[model samples]
Each structure stands twice: as structure tokens, then as C-alpha cells.
Target chain A: MATREIAGTTVEVNDEGYLTNPDQWNEEIAKVIAREEGIGELTEGHWKVVKFLRDDFKEKGVMPTIRRVKNAGGIPTKDLYELFPEGPLKKSSKVAGLQKPASCI
Target chain B: MMKRVLILGAGTAGTMMANHLARRLDRKDWSLTIVDQHKTHYYQPGFLFIPFGVYGEQDVIKSKREFIPDGVEYIEQKIELIEPDSNKVRLGDGTVLAYDILIVATGSKIFPEEIEGLKEDGWFKNVFDFYTIEGASALREALKDFKGGKLVVHLSEMPIKCPVAPLEFTFLADWFLHTQGIRNETELIYITPLSEAFTKHNCAVVLNYLLEEKRIHMETDFNVERVDETANRIIGYDGREIDYDLLVTIPTNMGDPVIARSGMGDDLNFIPTHKHNLQSKSHENVFVIGDATDLPSSKAGSVAHFQGDVLTENILNFISGNPLKDDFDGHANCFIESGFGKAFLIDFNYDIEPVEGTFPLPVIGPFSLLKETRVNHMGKLAFRWIYWNILLKGRPMPGIKTRMQTLGKRLPKIA
Candidate 1:
């Protein structure tokens, strides 16, 4: 079992190798998970979007749109767009360790 | 009594073996045959640069027979199976090729359909991959007309060829979107099953910083469950889902299907070749190389090139009834594109992971190991040219050695 702290939250990866708590997921969590999963690197912007997705999921029971996330997460739309430039619907969200959202289509 | 050599799938590895063997064996001594269903050959690594308009589709494709030696017989048919014990190969047309030496270079296949729902609803509609010529050309069209929305790149699984390709796509997409002035309209995401940007901790550290600088969002530890194309979402095993307007994915890559038919492959159709000797464990006269072998490393062109050298020596030794040398150290080198027209190089083997060091020579390196530079980017582009002319010809590359050496590599200084 491995334990890591992401953005002030302690996330525990159990012996079964699953991240035990969903709340422990954050930007750092995304980075840690990326390393653990063989995907490389998570930036601060990645954290901002992942955290937004986590928070959005908690609040609305749905993953927020990239546009919705930009405003809600306090990140400028341009920065968010630039961060994802391809749009935030694909593997970027997966790499952030955020749960897939239904409205992602 | 002439010796017969049957080469499977006249791709890079198969074609190179045919050319090399043709030069090695006289017509009086041996007969060589190259088999492939497709008439055209493709430069696979160039697929990565294609969607970015760096390399056109036409630039990467050529006739498979174009590079094969004139003396080598080219068989245009699908392989049915390999009877290794009997030293016989069965073709789709019921033709049997009896061989004294068999080389399995059938390479890999993209099974996007293997992933649940990946090919179901939004396969070509929204989901795309650049690993193939058709996929790349389609992705180019998708990227050209794509105005905003969420764009995602996913690595279906590990051990895929050119592991850094997804990250390169992310960076290039950023560059592409920015250039088109639609940078504000889109969001880019990169999802993978890996813990970091790369397998190596050192490279991951550098790439992590770069991802931050580029503002590319990432999702780690995502084991994709299904691609809900109808709903336009990627669902994970953990019950999370990502919606996308466009999905560029490196779908599940498996060994060539012919391996399974030949009863010479593992669960994924990858041939179980001896890690060191590159020989088929089931048969003495059979050998495997390139993406076909179940080796623990990135399935890149360089690895195939290195394996070619080792297999060449081992094959000759087997012919002479000499003790075979397991000299292949699993050496692999890759040029990583780090966006902004810069790339990085990493050279390592099975024993030594990629470390921060100068490549080729000590004190001065034409290309920096684990560090991004324009020179490395140029080198990445230059490899396509070399692939066609020098590498396919089985000619020796200057300053590049098949075995990995760690002389000038600097160990990380601990505090």
C-alpha cells in the first residue's frame, strides 16, 4: 500500500492498488497517479482542472465542461483553453485522475 | 541443396532481414523469401509527426517490394500459420513455405476494437489514432476543422510503440491550436495508465515541469473501461467518465494476428522470443524481432535496429554450429518531442534505465540526453530520411552503437 499527499489531502493507495478515497484526489494526486500509472507529469494547471472536476463532480454529480470549469475553478478561460488547447474532454481529464463525466460528449 | 529462409511481413524488420541476408548468402548457398499481405510499406514513427502536418501521408508510405532485394522472392499473401517443428509455413492461399531458418517480423496491430465500445459508436466519428496511415490522415482532418471543445488523447495500454507519442500529440495540439488562434476555444487532456509521463523517474520529472509550463491537463491511473461513443464519453473502471468532442487514442496494440494463427504467440499474439538471443523459445531455427517479440521495453525503431544486429550474429552462429552469444542488452533509444519545436533524447538498455547523460561521446554531445533542444527535434525529423535510406538498407549508422554504454552519464547529486 502506498500513501501520498496531494494538495493537502492524504490519499491512500491500498494493497489492492486502488486510491481509497476520492477526496484525496487533487493536482498533486493527479501527478502521483500519473507516475503510478506510467503516464508522465502533472502540471499546476492540470491540478486546477482536476480539482475542478473533483469539485464539480461532488456538487453537480457530473463532470463540468472545460468552459464551466475555467470559470468555476477561478482559472481564466484562455489559460484553461491553452492548457487543454485540444479541449478538455479526452485523456487530459483521465490523466488528471478525475472520474469520467457523462456530459463529456 | 540450397537453404531456404522464410521472412514474415516485409515491414522494417522483415525487409531489413531480407536485404541483409541477401547480401550475406550467395544464391548458390541460400534462398530468401519475404512475405506480406500489403503491397505498400509505411514509416510508422512518421505517423506521430503526420497529424501536425510535419510529415504528409505520402511521405511515410512506399511499396513494400521497393526496399526488398531483387534476389529475395516477394510473396504477396497473408500468412496462415507457422509449423515450427516441421519447419513449414502455411499461407492463406494454401501455399506452404518450407524453411531451414524462419524469421518472424510480423510486427504489431492496432486493436481499437479490443477496448470495450472504442469502435462501437464514435470510433471514426470522434475517436482516432495516429498509429496507422488511415488513422493519422483522419486525425489530421479532425484537427483541421476542430474548433474548440474538449480534445483528449489516451494511451490504451503500456508497451505501445513510441511511448512519448501521446505527450507529443498533446504538445503539438497546443502548438496547432495556438497557431490557428483557436487556443481559447479548446481544452486538451492526456490520459494514461502510467504513473508519470514516462517510465523513467528522471524523464518524468522533466516532463512534469513541461506539462505544467504548457498547461496541458493530465489524468493518471486511469484504467479505461469503455469508450461510450454514443454518449461521447470515456468511462473508466473506477466509474468516472470523460466527455469529448474529439478523442485521439493510441488504442490497444497487440502482436500481429498471424502469430496467433501460427500458434507462436502469447495471449496478446506477441511472440515469446528469448529476451537475449531473440530466438523463438518453442523452436531452435525460428527467430523473432521488432514489435513481434515480447520484450520488456518500448517498442521503437531503435530497439528493432539493435535487435537486428544481435539476431544477425546469433543467426550466423547457429548456421556455423557455434555457441550462440546472447549479446542483445535490450538497448533502446528514443527522441521525445517536448513541444515548442524542441525534443529530447534518452538512451538506455534493460539493465540501465535512461539517465541524465551525454550520448555518443563524453564531454561533448551532439544531442543532450534527457534535455530538450532544437537539435533533438531536428534529429527526430532526420530519422525519417535515415529510416528509408540508411536503416532499411541495413547499413551502419555513424556514431551510433547497438550496445548501450554508460561512461559519461552523470549520477544525480544527492543533497
Candidate 2:
């Protein structure tokens, strides 16, 4: 496991730099991770996706897919890409403190 | 003096040619040698299934030596240059190998760096390509936690190996996302430089309809100029921009660099080949096959398989002082995986477009042409087995002819 300091908080990451443990994720850490992903700050739209992903992952023990986030989280399909540029699920799931999704490619 | 036959790149085309020529040519009259940089032989078609976990790492890799016949010498070395005039090739180790006959089968490769920002910041992180083993493995991990957004499958340019692969990936993505219950949330888009879903008009019509049925957006004639990693968008040469949450792109495909260095190839390093005879236009002794040739054929494995038979016959004819048969009709057969346990099979040649019909047999086709069927899916699955055991061995498949068959094809009505 690789470890990185996001907003002064140490987080375990996989080989691809995705969060290995979702339990250690915090809002501050997500902002820092977003900055690292080239996004300056987490907007209100970004938080909606991040919170939905985190809440759903905690409840279902699995990360929420784009459909789940749109249908249950009330986020539109276009807004997801708007909030998280280039690999919204990957970037948002990482910000939400979840493991990297497998097989999107 | 023994007639020496040298084959470059012991991949699909070269390996099959080595096996085919070894069986046909006289042992006393010819000595065969095949050279490749890597000792491992990868089932490249299986790379498509890797990200989906349908094929494991071990399933695609095998020793190149195992495929080479006993009489053929296999050299694991990089080819430095091909001096066609001298009838010899220079190896990376400075050894010169002279040949009476040469076969160039060094296939095409993805040039990601050719596109601006393609190999920059977001490469392998946000932007992923499943064209290679490492790329596929990395993509597999990326897909696991994907919540979803705009999943764009882009083709940087045409003349790519397995032209249907991107379509297959797009279709499979739909199935995968739906299975993960994210299909409705994700916007699936396929962007190609071509004006339609595919190169062939008839096949494109069917494929376009399927794309509409699956709710996948098709962006045609999208000639990508650059990728803005920071903006998460792909910009076209015409200033068209498509935003994507995730992008799977097939970069520009180019032939082997050795061909360019040898000055024996076209602008893209593909050997100028005779479309019907498979012989190099510049050098009579040199024959080109697979993706290495500048022939108007799909750069797919099936074309290589068909070319293998035609090339072997022509090479023998050239040696025996006989007229070469122009039998190679650019016959290409491809099985398109349309997801949901169904696939479409198409058979066509240089002159004919993909039409609705049965393959190999007239009335009774276990496989349907230009139509999706479950049995076509089975045939697609069964091909991987056939590739290793029969295709690689250069053995003839029963009831399958090398040339395109028009026996059962229902041609499209002329307008």
C-alpha cells in the first residue's frame, strides 16, 4: 500500500493512487485530493457527487455508479462530467475516499 | 547454395508464414529463420477481454519458440535495417542476414505520443488505452470503482488493427455498466474519424442502428487534434470539443520503425504491397502481410489469416518460375460482440460490402451475417481456441475457404 499526505492527513493509496481505505476519508482530504487531480476546489456540484458516493458506499459497501448517483443522488448525467473533469467516476470516487473502480475502460 | 528465407517479427503473420512455408517448401532447398525482439507471443485479440476479466494474463501469453517449427530457427533479436538491394538484413547486434526471400510481418502499434497531451498528465490516470497488456490491466483497476459520467471511446485515426475492437469495447462497456447498474447514469459515446459507425457502408447501417438501439451516442468524423488533460476534453482539428469524464482512445497506428529506417516503406512505414499478390511493390523478393502492408483491407487478424494462405502459394509460385495467382481478394471476416449474449458476424471482400446472409454454407449457417445472433457470439468465443490450435499451426479449417464466398450472401438492393 502506498501512502500520501492529502491536506496533512495521511491516506493509503493503491498503485494507481486511488484511496485504499474509504473509512479514513474526510471533506478536507477530498478538497486536497481534488486539488491534486487538477481541480482547484470542490464546488457545490462536486460535493453532491462526493457526498452521494461516500454515503452510498458506506450504506451498500459498494461505490455508487453513475446511474445510482444520478437516480438516487438527483445529479444529472451531464453535471457529473462538469463537476469532475476527465474520468468523473474515478476522480469523484477518489475524492469521496473510495477504491478506484475496475473495468471502466 | 541453400535458399534462405528470412521472416521479420514472429507475431501472428510471421509465425503463421513460418509454419506455412516450412511445410510447403523443400527442407533441402530452403533454410527458414524468424526474428523478433520478444520471446513471448501474445494473443493480441485477447487483449480486448482483459479489462473485462474475461481473459487472464496467462491466457494471452505464450512462448514464441513453441510456435516455430523444429526446422525453423527462431532469433530473439531486433531488426536494425533491411537492405533490400543487397538481399540482406542487419540485426541490432551488427550481424548481417542474407536472404533469397523475405517476409515483412512487423505489425502496427499505437502511437499515443503522436497526439498532443495524449501522453501527458492524465495518461493512464484519467485517460486510458486498452490496446496493450499494461494498458488493459491498468484500465481494469480504473473501471472497478467507476461511478460513471461521460464514457467516451475515441478513435484517433483509422487503419487501426481490428477496426471492430473499439465498437466491441463500446458495446461491452454498455453491458458492463448496465450490469453494474450504472448504464442509465453514464453517457456512452463512440467517436470515430469515419463518417459512419464503420468503414463499410452496409455494415455501418446495421451498426449505426444498433448504436441507436443501445442509446450509445456516435460522433463521426471526429479527427482529434489534441487532448486537454486539464479541461478533460478532446479537441478536434475543426475546433470541435467533446467533454468526457473518462476517455478510452485508440491512438494513431503506425507500422514498424525499422521499415522507415530501411527506406522500404510508405509515409506511414507500411510496405507498398500488391493488393492481389501480397508482394512488395519495391522489392519482388520481399512479401508483406498483415498490418505491415498498405493494402485496402481491414488491419485485423482474419485478413492476416486469409493472406497467410495466399502469400504461401504466391511465394512458392515465385520460386518455381510460375505466374503468381491473384487469388487474394481481401476476404475479411469479423465477429462483432454486441453485448447481451449476442454478436454479429460479417464477411466481405475488396469489391463486396458486408451483406445479410449465411457464412461457409448456403442455407444452414450456424453463424449469421450482418445480423446479431447468439450463435455468432459462440463462434466469436470459439475463435480464440481455433486461433491457437489451428490458425497458428497453419492448418486449414474445415468448410472455411480462404477466399470470400458469395454463395449465400443477400446483396443490398441497388438504389
Candidate 3:
């Protein structure tokens, strides 16, 4: 684990840069993470996806996959890609302060 | 009063459960019955070889009744719905059967229709899935007639049954093409939703290098949007398109639709099962095994074989008024056929990644793990016999254990 200064706070993250301490995250951190992921200006559309990830992870104890985010989170697949291009779930979860979805090998 | 144990879907898991309980349960007190719509049981692993003409339909297909234990009643009927609350199952004929215990092994199926335009006119003609015997056979013929063009192997989603088969297919295809004297003419590509050749770190490093060595093109992080049948291409979420002359795809795999109708499955139609004990989260009398459950374990026959031991112990404990055993560690062992008369063996669980080491017999292992060997390839061929004679009969496989074994393995430090 490594520590990163994001949004003026020293928070811990994994080797992949996902937040190790999800509880330490706030909206400010999310915006910074999102910007780094090539997404600019968090719109209402983007917040919904982030909120869904946060809420679902809190309830299920695991980060949801792209299918779950699409099927259960009630977001269209196209909009998700449009909202956060290039591995949307990876970008969204990092911004949402959740660990990477452990893609089962 | 007599108790009835009902098993649904007489595939690998359910059939093994029937045989396991048949002898253990008292003949006078417990009655065993299994239900499935199909009469034939296909050796699913054999399907992978069918495309290369290593296995034929006759070799894989067998009567399901042959493996079922004596005194275990077999019902060849469609299960219409499962009523977990009432401890009953409704058949297609509107007949409801009460169960003291229910084992769901309905398994998963390839749903090509899930994607728009995937099941279009060119489905079997050009785009094919080898998950089924029909698709495998059709692909065999298609490969025979090929003048060698772009052969794209695609994975639509994750958690598909036999997770390694697509990679195996790509490797075998490379070998098959070379044998056909068309290796130079074929442009082979592997497209997946994963960011690399595999999700695990160690395996990915080795597999990615192999892909490069074999000159197979890699397209990663591409979640399929739809199939553009008119143009012979598949469009992903990023709007990236890959054209293919012959598309060998593993379509979105889902649990039986009956789970959806019964209002018990997740978004993918897999039941929410307890990862350790194999019990359904919501229903006490119900247990889930194999691909039907939404476990993190790979959906393969080896997993079902391991789960058989866990479920059997837990069910016996549950029936005897004892607490269920939360002893399953998700042990899964599979041989990755790498072609060129060589294969790789990987054994891991929910926690560990596939690392290099010797397996089963330890340091003196005739078959090495995570390294390609001809012995591993021989193991794959011999498994067909073991699968039918020993595995389905609930006979213990000599070297394997229910939980993941760390002995003889170079264990990785957990992150």
C-alpha cells in the first residue's frame, strides 16, 4: 500500500491506485480521481454512477461488475462508456473510493 | 415419517449429489430423486476437442441414467419453477413436488440471443459458439472449409462456464491451423473484457508472453455492445469494432431461466449462495452447487467435483441436527490446453493466484503447475475417462482434496 495526497488529504491506496481506505474518501477526492481518469467536470449523470458504486459496495461488501452496474444500477451501458470512457468501471470505482473489481480468472 | 431429497438438473453436480446421498441416507428413512429435462449428458470438456476433430459427438454423448445410482428415482421433466418458501418445486406439467431438501444444479447456458444481432442470419454460418455440441461440430466443419482469414475469438462476459476453454480454443486453433498448413494465412485474434490475457497476475504474465510468442493479436477491456452482422463485426462499449471472417465467441453465460421465473436469481440468474457452505442465502432447505450459484469460483467440472464433497458433508450435518460445515475454500483445478502437445495445470482458490509449483504429488510431480508440459496434455486426455467413471459416480479422485492444498506449491503472499 502507498499513500497519496489527493484533494489535500493523505489517503492510502493500492498498487493500482484504488483507494485502500474507502471511508477516507469524500466528494473532493472523487472529483480529483475522476479528472485523473480522463473524465472532466462531474455532471449529475456521473454522480449517479459513483453513488451507485458507493452504495452497492457498502451493502454487498464487494465492488460491482460492469454488468451489475448496468443491470442493477439502472444505467445504460452506452451512457456509462460516454460518462467515463476506457474501462468505465475501473475509472468509476477508483473515483467512487472502492477497490478494483477482482475480475475472476 | 419419510423425508424426500430432491435434486434439480442432473448435470455434473446434481448427478454426483444423487449418488453421494444415495448410499449415505438410510433406505427406509430418506428417498432420493433427481430431475432434469434432458436425457443425455455431454462431457463438456470434450466439446473443446470437438472443433479440432479430437473428439466426436458419440464420444461425448452418453445416457444420463448410466451414472445415476440405483434406488435413486430419476425424473426426466422440465422444472417450471422453484417455490423456496413453501419447500416445493413445480414441474412443467403443473405437478408440485415437496422437498425436505433441494439441490439446485441447473447449471449455466450460452445465450447468444442476449446481444442484439448476434443470433442473426450468419450465426452458425460464420459466427459460432463452441459451448454446445452443435456449435462445436459446426465450427469443425467451418474450419475445414476455411481458406484462412481473420479468425477472431471473442469473450462477451466473465464468469462463463469453463473459463479457460476460449483461451484453449485459441491455442488449439493455432496448432490446428499450422497442421492444416494455413498458419501463415490466418490472422488470429483474442478479444476479451479483461485488461490482459488473464485476470490473475502471475498467469497473465506468462499467458500474455505466450500470446506474443504465438503472434495472436490481443484486444482487451472491450465489453461488447452489439454484433454488427451486416458488417461482420462486434462493437464494444467504447465503440471500438473488430472485424472477423470467422467469429468463435463465448456469448453471455447465464443460469437457467427458471431461476428468473421463480424470482430467486441475481442479475445473472445465479442463485445467491453461501460461498462456504453452498447453502442458499435466503432458503434454509435449499442448497446450490456448480454454475447455478454465483460463487467467485470458476464454473468448471473440477469445481463441481470439489463442491460435491463440501455439500455432502454440510447436508449430512444439516439432516442430523448439527450445524453445517463452512469448510469449502473454493478449490478449483483445471488443465489449460496450450496446444503443440503441451498444456498447463493451474490450481487455486478464492484467495490465491495461480503460481509456479508442483501439484497433487508434490515435488516429484509428473505433471507440473503453471508451466507447459506434455504430461499436462496427457492428463487432459485421461480426464475424460476419470470424469465419467469416477467423478460423476461420487468416487473420490485420488490426489485432489475438497479444500485448496498449499503443499508442494510456491504460495504467494496475500495482498
TM of each candidate vs. truth: 0.79, 0.79, 0.97
lDDT of 3 by residue, B1-415 (tens): 8899999999999999999999788779899989999989999999999999999999999999999989999998999999999999999888889999999999999999988889998899999999999999999999999889999999999889988899999999999999999999999999999888876778889999989999999999889999987899989989899999999999999999999999999888999999999999989989999999999989999999999999999889999989999888888899999999999999988888887788787798877999999999999999999999999999999987888888889986766
Count of steric clashes across candidates, in order: 46, 14, 0
Candidate numbers, best TM-score first, in rank order: 3, 2, 1
lDDT of 3: 0.92
Candidate 1: which stretches are off by over 4 Å? Answer: A1-105, B412-415
Q: Output the lDDT of residue B122, model 3.
A: 85
lDDT of 2 at B317: 98
Question: lDDT tens digits, residues B1-415, model 1?
Answer: 9898889988888888887888876578789998999988899888887887888988888988889988889999989888988999999899999999999999887898878888876766678989989989888888888889999989876667777788888888888889888877888888987767777667788888888888778897566778888888998755568988999999878898878777787656778678899998788999998889877766888888888888888888888899878888989888988777899898888767678778778758788898889989999989999999988888877888888877778765555
By lDDT, the candidates rank as 3, 2, 1
The per-residue C-alpha lDDT of model 2 at residue B400 equals 87
Q: Could you tell me the interface RMSD of model 2?
A: 13.4
**lDDT per prediction?**
0.79, 0.87, 0.92
Give model 1's TM-score versus the native structure: 0.79
Q: Report lDDT (Cα) of residue B136, candidate 2.
A: 88
Considering only chain B, report the TM-score of each candidate against the true chain B. 0.97, 0.98, 0.99
